[model samples]
Target: MDFSFPKNERIKSKKLMEAIFTEGKNLNNFPLKLIYLPSDFDDDTQFKVAVVAPKRNFKKAVDRNRIKRLMREAYRLNKGVIFNNSERDFALVFLYLGKEMPDFQLMESKMTGLLEKFLKKIANEEAV
Candidate 1:
């Protein structure tokens, strides 16, 4: 499968962002947190996501931006877990919650675990 993170697959709408935070369910793995909301969107992409690094934890813009970049790369590589397994659209937010910086390997592994947990939860819910 193509592993490109096109702009259309990224979240940019203020309304959608607010809806994600207000109506979404969260799955967390320490430094990474995923908040996901099932929704209908005009785009054909199965998921539209945003990555955020809080300024409170990372005081410098450079630090926050680096964290966001790492989060995005990890998500881009690992998002197929949801894309291939599910048949619905979701607005997802990936939040960086740690006070310290993390390497890409750590980020990617945790992201994979978080997505797996999400799949299990969704499967259980649907089965029930």
Candidate 2:
């Protein structure tokens, strides 16, 4: 399967983003917090996502950009954990929450765990 994170899979709609933050469920895993909304779609093969690094925490633009870049790379590499298992479409936002900068390994590990937790949570919700 193609693992590339293309433009189509990136969440770019302002209205949708606002709705996701206001109404979506959240899961936190230190360094990374995910806000997600499950929605019906004609094509279930795609997930729209965004990575965010808050300026309040990371003061410098370079720091924020680096965090966002790491988050995106981690997600792009590990996204199959969600894409392969889920039958529904999801809109997700990854929020960086650490007070300090994290290394690549830490980000990858946490991102994997976060995605696993999200899958379990979604399964539980659907089973209820």
Candidate 3:
């Protein structure tokens, strides 16, 4: 597995973001709201993810950046489980929804659980 989260697999395009908001399913645990859609890329080695914190929740840019950084760090460390699995190429957007800033460990745990649930959801959908 290429441990890198490359740009091509990322959901950066405005069209893809709109599709995720309008077409993809939503999943959440605590501080995270996940919006995802399966990628057309057939490669089974890498996935792309984006972390976002709404300006409404965090009025200050610094706070939003901090939260996004923490979210990315958590995802980076735990994403190995997802990349190694058969369903590797996907576009995932993670939004931080909670009002208050959460500790890194707490956010990490929530991110990990959400990713596991995401993997299971994909597998189940493929099975159908």
Which candidate number would show the highest TM-score if scored against the true structure?
1
After TM-score superposition, the amount by which residue 128's alpha carbon in candidate 3 deviates from its true location, in angstroms, is 1.7
- Give the higher-TM-score candidate: 2 or 3: 2
State the lDDT at 68 in candidate 2: 93
| TM-scores for the candidates | 0.96, 0.95, 0.87
For model 1, the stretches where C-alpha displacement exceeds 4 angstroms are none
Clashes of each: 0, 0, 0
Count backbone clashes in candidate 1.
0
lDDT tens readout by residue for model 1, 7-115: 9999989999999898899999998898999889886888898999998888999999999899888888887788889887878899988889999999999999998
Alpha-carbon RMSD, each predicted model:
0.9, 1.3, 2.3
> Would you list the rank order by lDDT, best first?
2, 1, 3
Model 3 TM-score (2 dp): 0.87
lDDT of 2 by residue, 58-95 (tens): 88999999999999999999998899888888999999
Question: Which has the greatest lDDT?
Answer: 2
Better of 1 and 2 by lDDT: 2
